[model samples]
Target: MIKPTLDEEKKETKFSKKYWKYDGLHVISFTKAGLREENQDGISIEFELNDKLKESDDRLKGYYLFGVYDGHGEHGDKISDDCVEHLSKYIAKRLYELPIVENEKEIKNAIKKGFDDTENYFKTHDINGIKGNKVRMSGTTALTVMMTPKKNLYIAFVGDSSVFFMSSNKSKKINIEHNCHNQNELLRLRALRQKGFMYSIKARSGRKYLRVKDDLSNEIQYTRSFSDFYIKNFFSGGLIAEPEIIDKVYSAFNLDLLVLASDGITDRSKIFNKHPTEIYLSYLKRYKGDPNRFVKACDEMIKLCDSITEKRICVDDMSIIIIIILNGKSEDEWCHIVTKNAEDPEDWDNTTHEDELSDIDDQDIYNQNSNEVDDFLVSVPLSTIPIEYYDEDSAMNFTISDDDNFD
Candidate 1:
C-alpha cells in the first residue's frame, strides 16, 4: 500500500479499477510503468501499459501477444487505467459472444461497436471525481490488439498510438490514427485556424500539453476565424469510433511478429530510434517460448528506452507487445527475400514488408494496392473535448455497413 506524508496527505489518491481476460489457448500478461517529471509548464505524467499474450494450452490455440498504451497528463491516469481495462474487457466480451468464423467484416463491426459504445458509456456517466473534477476534464488515447486462433487478429486506435507488423514477405506500418493530420484534416485545421480557431498551447518537444496536434504544423494552428475545439480536436481514439484499421486481417498477410505502441516509444523515425521491435527481436530470438524471459526482456527494453534526464517521456511510458506467429517467416528469410528482390521493381514497390506488416496491424493486405494511394492522403486528425458533432446525429458520423458484411 502507498501511504502519504503530511505534505502529501492533502493530495492523496484513493482510486483503483481493473479488468482482465485470457482464453484457454493463450496466456496474456500486462505490466504498467510510469514517470512523473517536474517542468516549468506544469506537472506532466507519462506512463506505459504493456501486454504479452501467449498460447497457454498450446493445442494449436496458443500465440504470443504484445501491446502498449502510453497516455499523458497527471490526472489522465484514470482515463488511461479505464481505457486499458475497458479495452480488454470490451474485446473479450464481444469476441466471446461472436460466432466462430473468419468473418473479417463481423470482426470489424464488433470492434467498431466496442469503441463507439465505450465512448458513449463514458459520456453518459457522471465522471465527477474521476480525474480531478477541476482540470476541465480528463481522458486518454486507446491503442489495442486482439489475436485469435481462428487465424485472425485485429487492432483499434484513438490517437497516435501505432502498430508495426513483420513477416518474410514484408513489414507494414499504418496511420490508424484518425486525427487532424490526415490530408483533409490538415486542410481543415488550416481553414479553422485561418478562420480564427486553434488550441492555445505552443508546440514544444519536451512539454506535454493538453492542446491538440496539427500534423502539417507541429503546433496547433491559430487563426482569427473558426475556433472550434470540438472540430479542432475532432477525432477520438477512446470509445468514439472503431480505431482506424492499421491492418484488418493479420493471418491473411502471413504475419510473423507485431509491435503495438504509443508514439512515445519511438516517435518520428527521423528522431528517436526507428525500430525497437527489430532491435528487441534481434536479441530475443534465442529466448522464444518462455514467458518469464520474454516478460523480463520486455521490461529491460523499456528501461533502456527511457532516460531520466530526458525532458520528454523517455521512451515516454513506453509499452510494446511482440507477437510471434508460430510458422511465420524468420528475420533471415525476410532479409534474404528483401536483398534478393530489392531490385525486382515489380515486387519492390508493392512489397508489403510482410514480416513487419502483419504484426504491426490488421491492415487489409489484399487492398494494399488501394492503401498505397491512401498513403498519399495519410494525415493525423484530432478531436475536441465534447466533440462538436457528438449527439444523436453522431451515429451518422460513422458510415459503416448496417450489414457490415452485406456490402
Candidate 2:
C-alpha cells in the first residue's frame, strides 16, 4: 500500500475543529478533556476522499471515514493524535493497490492492517521514552467506521469507544467494548490463559472491577487497546493491540443519524441526566434530519457536560461525531426505501411505544445495564511505582492485594 504524505501537523490548532462532508454524508465532531488538565482525546472524520484517488478507483468515490481515539497515560495525547494523523493515509495507500471490486472483506482487512501498522509503529519506536531511557507505554480505545458508495458499512474498534446507527424507531450499537469485566472479553482472556492473572477490586463507589498488572506491579483495567504494554510483555495478547472488525452491506440507508462517541459522551453517572440514545434520537427529531443542525446539536450536548460542575460525579475526555445520512436528500423519497415501510405508525407492525422500548431494552440489555465506571481498566504501568514491588512479586501470580481498593 502506498503511504500518504506525512505532513501531519503536531500542533493541536492545525487540525479542523468543525466538520467534514461528501455528497450526502455530513459529519460534525467535537472533543474536550472535560475536567482533566489536558485533553487526551483525538478524532478524525474524512468524508471527502482525495479527488485523484476517487478518479483512479471508482469504488473509493463516495466512501466516508469516521474515527475516535481516547488515549490514556503520560503520552496519551501523542498516541491518539498520531493514530488519527496516520491511519487514513495508510488505508488509502492499501486500497490504491487492490483490484476495484466491491469486496467488503478485503476492505475490512485493509482497515485492520492500517490499525495494526499504526500500533506497531508506536510500540517499536523510541519516540516516547522516559528519563530512564525506557519506552513509555500508553493506550487508547479506537472506534472507526467507513461508509462506501454502495452503502456498505465496516466497523473496526478496540476498548470502550462506541458507534451507533439510529432511526426514528430504533437505535442499534455497532461496536463491542473490550473490558475485563465484560463476559465475552473475560471468556476470550480465559481462552488465552490470561484470566488467572486478573483480579477484581471493589471501588468506594460500590462498583466492582478488574485489573492486570505490569512487571512493576502496576495495574491496568481495559482488556484490549492500541498500546505497547501488551507487546512489552506487560500483559497478555488478550489485552491485544488489534481491533475487532465487522462488515455489512445495506440495501438502502434507513438510518436517520449515526453517532460515534468516546466513553465520556455516554457516561450516565455524570450530570448529562439522559442516555446518549435518548438525547441523540431527540436531537435527530428536533432537526428533522437536517445536516446543517449538527453543529448546534453537538454544541447543545457539550453544554450539558459543561453545565455539570455542581453535580459532576463523572468527568473525562469527551468526543462525538454525528453523521446525518439524509442530509441534502429527499427524506420522503428515501425513508420508505430505507425502512421498507410507510411512515405512518398505525400501518406498521402492531406494537406500542412501551413494546418498542422493551424490544430495544431486551436486545441491548447488557450495554444498557453497564456502569460508566466499568468503561476504564486499571492501567498503572510499572513506571508509576517503585521497583521493589516487582522484586517482591516477580513470580507474577495473579492474586488480589490489600491495596486493590479504589476508594
Candidate 3:
C-alpha cells in the first residue's frame, strides 16, 4: 500500500510567516495502526506558532509551528501496538510552552531535559511486556527544529529521522543520524559490546555501578532490539534512540522554512545520495519547494518503491513536518524599521542580536554522497498501495491547489 512520508503531510497544511524578523513552529504527527494487515501506515500531526507574542513584541509576533510523528518498518506499527502511545501527545503539550530561550545552550538544555523526563516517565509506567524485558526491541525516533528571527536556528535528530533547512545560501543535513549500526555507532557499540563490572560511590551517600559484556560474537547482540519486556532498561521509551547526536546553533542562522522528517526522506537521500538537508535545497526549486509538493513527490517515490518490489521488501511507515517561519509582524512596519537603519547606520541598532554565538563554517562534510551510493546497492521495494488509499478527497479540507510558486 502507498504510505505517506513526513514531507507528504506538509503539502496539506500551509501557514504564513511574515510577522516576525524570526519565527518558530512545532508539529507532532503520530502513527496509524494495523499497517501489517492493510499494508499501510497511520499518522497525526499538529502545528502551531507563538500566538501570544503578537502582543508582547512586534518582532516576536506570530509565526508557524509543525511537528511530525512518523513510524516506519515495525516501529510505526508498534506505536499503535502500544509501544509508543501518549508520548506524541505529551511532546505536543510541552511545546505549547514556547518563546523558548533565544539562546542555544538554553534551548539545548530544555530539549535534553524534556527527553530525559519522557524517559523517566516511561520507566515508571512501563508498557505491556515492553519494559524491563531481556529481549524487547521496540523504539521510536524524533527529528526537531527550532528557529527564531535573526536569532538561532537549530535542528537535531536522535535516530534515523532527519530535518532539513532549505534556503538560498545553503541546504544541508543539520540533523545527525544516530542509528546504532552506523559505522561510528558500531565502533562505539563494539567498545560497549563487552566488558567487566565495577562500582563507585560519588560520596558517602551517592553510589554507581557498571557492567560490561563481551563482543558481539561472544555476547548476545540484542542491538536489533531488546526483549519487549526489557525495552525500558535498553532504550528509554519515547526516546529517539540511536547513537550520539549532532547539534548546532547559529547566531545569524535563519531560514524561510524548516523540513523535519523520518527515514522515509532517507530513502530520497539514498536516491540522490544527497544528505536529507540537501534534498530540500536541490529539489526546492524543482518542486517549487512547497512542503506539500515535496511530500507528494516523496509519496510518489514510495509508490515507485512498490512498483519495483512488487510489494515485498522494505515497506516502511513515513512522516514529515514542514514549518514555514513567519515573524507575524507588520510587513510595512518592519520595512520602516529596517529601512530606517539602512538610511542611517548606527552601532546601537536594536534590530537583532546577530553573531551572539560562535560562527562555525559549513564544513566539507564527511557524508555519504548520493552519487556514490549507487556503487553499494541492493534493491527490494515494498510499497503496495490499494486503490482505496486515495479515495479520500481531503482529510482536512485544505483547499487543494496546483499552483506551485509560493516564494
For candidate 3, what is the lDDT? 0.34
Model 3 lDDT, residue 290, Cα: 45
Candidate 3, residue 223: lDDT: 30
Candidate rank order under TM-score: 2, 1, 3
RMSD of 1: 14.4
User: Model 3 over residues 31-82: C-alpha lDDT tens digits?
Assistant: 3111134222223332223232223333332222233433332332443223
Per-candidate TM-score against the hidden true structure = 0.54, 0.69, 0.49
Misplaced by over 4 Å in model 1 are 1-34, 37-67, 127-136, 176-181, 187-242, 268-273, 285-300, 308-315, 328-407
Ranking by lDDT: 2, 1, 3
Looking at model 3, which ten-residue stretch has the lowest summed lDDT? 357-366
Question: What's the C-alpha lDDT at position 111 in model 3?
Answer: 51
**Which pairs of residues collide in model 2?**
219-380, 220-378, 220-379, 221-377, 221-378, 222-377
Model 2 weakest 10-residue run by lDDT: 357-366
Q: Compared with the true structure, what per-residue lDDT tens digits does model 1 show for residues 1-407?
A: 11111111112232111112223111112233333331101111111111212223323233222335443334444555555555554544454456665467776777667666656555554343642232223445666665655556676666556677766635566443434323333343445544444322111111111222223222322111011113324422111233565554656246655666554443322132235455445434433445443444454444444432132212234444454444544434433442332222232222223323212211111123332211112111122223342233222121111211112
Q: What is the alpha-carbon lDDT of model 2 when measured against the actual structure?
A: 0.55
> What lDDT score belongs to each candidate, Candidate 1 first?
0.38, 0.55, 0.34
By TM-score, is 1 or 2 better? 2
Which ranges in model 2 have alpha carbons more than 4 Å from their true place? 1-17, 49-59, 127-135, 194-196, 199-219, 230-232, 247-252, 268-277, 283-292, 327-407
lDDT of 2 by residue, 169-188 (tens): 46666655655335566556
